[model samples]
Target: MSRLMRISIPTIRVVPQITPGPPPPTVAEAVERVVAFLAPGNVAVLTGAGVSTDSGIRAYRGVEGRYLNPNFKPMFYNDLIEDSPRGHSFRQRYWARSFIGYPRILATRPNPTHAALATLMRTSHVSQLITQNVDGLHHDALRTKDPELHSRILELHGTLHKVHCRAHHTVLRDEYQMQLALLNPYWAELEESFRRTGNKPRTNPDGDVELEGVSFDDFEVPACPECQREGKVEMVMKPEVVFFGETISQQVKDRSYEVIEQADRLLIIGTTLATYSAFRLAKHALELSRPVLLLNLGPTRADGLPQLEKMVVSSGPVLQEAARQLASSRLSEDANLREVLEGGIVTSIEDV
Candidate 1:
């Protein structure tokens, strides 16, 4: 049995090592200790919305998580494409939110956690980064410097930067222009609604929008490109996101499993793993006797992972300290990039 499994309890204590410095041991100290435990082979990082919180994105399960009238419920892949009112409803809310929210998301920058992981990849410390966030921040972070050293960021959730047709699966980029043109009057109203209510829509872990008091009739939906070519142009639809009662595609599941199989340790940052799809993946990692380290401010469904090592804390400062240490010793070239990841989570250890 692995060390994690050998432990009697579900939890393990993490004691920070104190050392003299301008600042004392921070959350970064904990992350550094965890990263140091990773073996030389494949070190897989399974990240969630927490990593992007510093980048101005809101997490779903914490105090800042979305919980409103037009609140989001998980969707399944099967339900998204099926012709039904529920599916139509799901698609409508998704497109409406995406049409209004994608631009704001695109304007966000990567946080320290992202840069640290990318640096880990460049220095051969990390084998792969498996992320549930679809904001494309990881991809964007990797692009800031050398393309050759760009880390391999496996986006478990589909990316928001592009859209695909449900019927033919023909992918397109920057099609927001077309969506805006079609949305017309409704688009203006939606923007005005947000402004009037001072409501800032948050992007969920599944890459869907979270809102309230909004209906499908308020937005325009586009039609498939392939179907349009065949003179069957109808409202083009894309799954708002993979939802509940739905399974992640076999292809996506298989790839995620493959990464899990190769991972020596599973480091979970900022996710509660509330959904079955993400929770099952963490469970599989635990069953393999892999060490599961969780860093989030709330309780996770997978808190029972065998020999789980966890810190119920915010991600920002913890990741910042980790980046600071790593950059000074091994990633000196990208010191400035690492600081951006440090944000609101910087409270004293006593506060935690």
Candidate 2:
């Protein structure tokens, strides 16, 4: 656990400790406009892959987004649920990738952007942090300072930390599936060699990496623990996330709408809003007459929506600089409300 797990109202002295980053001139005008939106201090923040890229995670559609690769095919719920089996090559391939990815994901730390959001939550500028990311870095940052702050964030897509038995609907935490893969003798041997060589194959946004010159057949996979314990066989265990082609739970969708509807404004950070699940939140905010600020490096499905107020092409610098500015500038109700009414909207980076 890092220091970010615990977020609190740090004293004035803390500001001087962390170097204050001025918003880049490229994004200065946009940041100024964006900081205006934060004036109301009841923003519902929606973050996506772009926010985490600074933390070393590649997104699906940025300049380096995985989607642009002609050969890349995202994991689909239908394929995982309907096509793969315990002995199928798909299962073997998934585990192979997990072996490469699990450690990398674990090694990822919350960057300044994540800390910035945590600060916003601490100051109450952000009413709630709604994310399409399942990385859990947001929750991890807020969890340390105040457990209650952790609850204010909603992970629209489930996290990768959990594993579930599709058949039994039982869930386990940590790296159980990966552990099982290691427990298998043959797979374990390959894993050991892969680690010893330090020549990791290329990996994608999904936690799996490529296994060059490796054969998938003859790999043995274990059944889920819950089912195995119950005398059942051939059960499949999957990361308990909302995979592509899957529907988010109705309860989650309703709760998200409730959050968006209640917010004074919506802040979209680091996402293209390509997925309807995330774009719908922006759409709903507009439906409720709420001003929406979308900050991403590229175009989004919400590009033409009249409801969108500001769209910043940058995420980390603007967010970090703005959040830091807000931390020092606004602590009173009047200051917050004043910024809201001033028409602070970041149009696009092109203007700058």
Candidate 3:
């Protein structure tokens, strides 16, 4: 049995880790610790935008869990629901910026961290790979390497690859982008020019770039096709991701909790646990007396919590090294099993 499994569960709720623990581990120490923690397998991996930063998606927060771009306001769920000029303008701005930025997100490939996670999943080390990112890069990476393990990934925030109307009419984001291009030919040309010149705008993690000195007042946003067919005046379509102030779907929340409950331990990567949704999972692990390992740089919301180990290091390299060690161990296990089978000592079978 693992050391983590022997820990006693707290009858009281686990609070956030506010006080500091020991000094941060060195890179070597961090790797060793990560390997030992994950070697027991059945680990639940909870990642955030930080994991996708290497693939060119900017994380919303800095190391300390503060917004990286203080001036930038995320599109709110309330803004999308308001039936006023402000809402219309907000919709226009969002779609216009998304039209320009979505292509870059599509163009980016998953990074080393994604590949390492996939390797871990393939080796049966991870019980659940839950990510707060909406970029769908994890899905992309898994499809390429560990296609069978795709079901193990739980996207806490909905994916950017899909768009939906207020009535829940959904469409493929690529098709919607083409529709946007058809509606706004001039902006499409501008986007093409920007791409050609290698002058892409910096985008937020939600796949929208900041635009200044550019007016989106005239930019067109297509209504949902089903809504249009049903004679609805304007059912604005938006990316399927959970907007700021929006609650995650109950189904997703239930699944996330289920995965956390079933795992032996929780491993957090690339996130500071700024959001309660992600932080709660770690708290749940601690509450269950299951160990929580955070492999992220800077301070997390749960930084000082007992039963949680924080390693201040880049997650990519640490994950890569851990995957390597785990893979090697798996090969050794397979060889041992093969040798046991070759010995022909299991000729007799007992029915239970």
Q: Pick the candidate with the highest lDDT.
A: 3
User: TM-score per candidate, in order?
Assistant: 0.74, 0.79, 0.85
lDDT of 3 by residue, 215-288 (tens): 99889888888788898865567788887777787778888888989999998999877677887888888999
lDDT of 1 at 65: 32
Per-candidate alpha-carbon RMSD to the true structure: 8.2, 11.8, 11.3
lDDT of 1 by residue, 1-352 (tens): 2111110112221212222223323565666675575435467778887677777676654532323223445544555566777667766766666666665666577766676666566555567778878777777666456655443567776666666665646555466546554656767576667657756666554444666676666455667666778888555466323434444556677777778888787777877665455667788888899877777665566655568777766665565555555555544455544443332222221111
Candidates 1 and 2 compared: the better one by TM-score is 2
lDDT for model 3? 0.77
> What is the Cα root-mean-square deviation between model 1 and the actual structure?
8.2
Pairs that clash in candidate 2: 5-143, 5-144, 5-145, 6-144, 6-145, 7-145, 39-336, 97-208, 97-209
Candidate 2 per-residue lDDT, tens place, 92-169, comes to 667656765666666566666687787688778898998877777786555355568877998888787777876745
- Candidate 2 lDDT for residue 73: 54
* CA error at residue 242 for candidate 2, angstroms: 1.3
Number of clashing residue pairs, candidate 2: 9
- Model 1 steric clash total: 13
TM-score of 3: 0.85
Worst 10 residues of 1 by lDDT: 2-11
